[model samples]
Target: MANHGPSYGLSRELEKKNQARFSLDEAIEVLLWVENVTQLPYSCDPTTCQNAADVADLLKDGVHLCKLINRLLNNGSRAPFNPKPKMPFQKMENISNFLEACKAYGVAEISCFQTVDLYENKQCYKVIECLRSLAAVQLIMSGFEMESIIWLWKLATSCEI
Candidate 1:
């Protein structure tokens, strides 16, 4: 019998594809856009950075990206034409999988774990920060938050988790 856990090869391939599709320059631009949308600080500039700082910035962005993904999965709005919507479990699952992949690929840092813990533990300010950070990322990733807004609304109104 074969073990049926998530496919490590598939995950790595997906991560590689994602990285190929979005280069560091593109990621930086996305991060800056997210920052502007969410009114957060844009901490990194692609033009000037040491390797360590670059890694740190990428990790920080990864944390923000995770939060945004969670918000989109949990409470984002929907597409205008999606009249009969399915649950967002798939999207949530995708985000979780992607985060795990990021960790595996060494793109995510230790601070991400700390941030996750802080959010889960109900550290009030940290939670708010997390939300803001995520919102920014979602705004960048989703192209105007249409999907996020709808998903969030559906999650709020639907009783059929």
Candidate 2:
């Protein structure tokens, strides 16, 4: 039984719109909204409603995944969340290596590689950047703000007024 939840589908949809972009601030606002909504007592169980609290957790997890990607790009192979050095390889020198480390760190371990391969062509540095754009659009689209589509385009092109 595979979990083709909203987060999973949204991640894939975002990958297809790789060239798209959105305002980081607005994206954060939506994420906060998601968190608040999920915290409500009426929130449905994750097994039944993907958009329920599960989506919020997934969004937060996505951000954490991005942080790990950035850290790997900057720190040169060391796992950002792992401090014990218990793993055989401490550094992620390439995309495959980074994905493996992510699996070890339990970041969507089962589908982590699929997500990475979809956005990055073995480029660790670009992983977070790509994910950031994808996440922004996903959040905005979910918010039903069609007019903001132009805003996303502008943000992607220049991030300037």
Candidate 3:
């Protein structure tokens, strides 16, 4: 018998990666478009840094949501983070199309557009930022770093309610 946990996951993951064959540049561009059109506070520029680091940064900024909730719980009125410009309806629709393209291109199985309520939930923008960051890693990350990238994905996907 052999250890099956990591090996099984790795094989499954490799199969999935092989099936999804989009270029790194394509993934990055779509993600960047989502970030820019949403006017998210965090940057999702793939040209500047590693995907894991970018995801970490977005997650760090997301901590403010907890601070914000705490302030509200304490009856404080001030906003915890600066407000971002509203993403126009046209731009939001465009982002949905871009995400669809990402999926159609087999870049990654992204579904944030389906669950995100862009009109009401501000946290959704941060989620999009994280998703875009993760999308950047699909083709570029090395075998040695895949575990860390998965951890980053888990962190990025969990949005505190």
Candidate 4:
């Protein structure tokens, strides 16, 4: 059986605490950047998203995510991993590969979301955090200011504004 979430008492309160940290605007930004970077196959207009749930739905399959990472790493059309996985296990495999690539691309292990996180909407904020980390690392590698990125990370993780 799958753990949907706690339904009562202290555990429920803790579960509620884990909710609502994600920003729709930042998620849109990440989606736009991904669309721009990978030219996603479908009509991806992230601006239309009303909430983080929408973003989660878009990325649940992990195909676009794989393509985004592939474009960043290879800068070509060749897909070394399975580009389109039909089964649940295969899709999870793609997400796993994507996580591994992000780690290899300088995203720390602690900063990454587990496959189930994105797949099951367990903690969607971590997905944005991983993407934000990837963007920061990529920018730093390309000679961007590290201090600014640090500030952004701090701002992102901090409580309220």
Tell me, by lDDT, which candidate is best. 4
lDDT of 2 by residue, 76-139 (tens): 6553343222222331223344455555443444334343332222222234344444434443
- TM-score for each predicted model, relative to the true structure: 0.28, 0.23, 0.28, 0.79
Top candidate on TM-score is 4
Candidate 3 residue-wise lDDT at 11? 81
lDDT tens digits, residues 28-82, model 3? 4444543443444345445453443343243333322222222223234323332
lDDT of 3: 0.39
Give Cα-based local distance difference scores for all models: 0.39, 0.38, 0.39, 0.75
Clash totals in order:
14, 2, 0, 0
TM-score of 2: 0.23
Task: For residues 31-64, write the lDDT of model 1, one tens digit per residue.
Answer: 4544544344445554453322352343332334
Candidate 1 vs candidate 4, TM-score winner: 4
Q: Give the RMSD in angstroms, all C-alphas superposed, for model 2.
A: 18.0
Model 4: which residue pairs collide? none
With a 3 Å backbone cut-off (N, CA, C), the pairs that clash in candidate 2 are 77-91, 77-92
lDDT of 3 at 149: 40
Q: Model 4, range 13-109, lDDT digits (tens) per residue?
A: 7557667678788888778777767777445567898866688878877788888777777444433456666777887888888898888777899
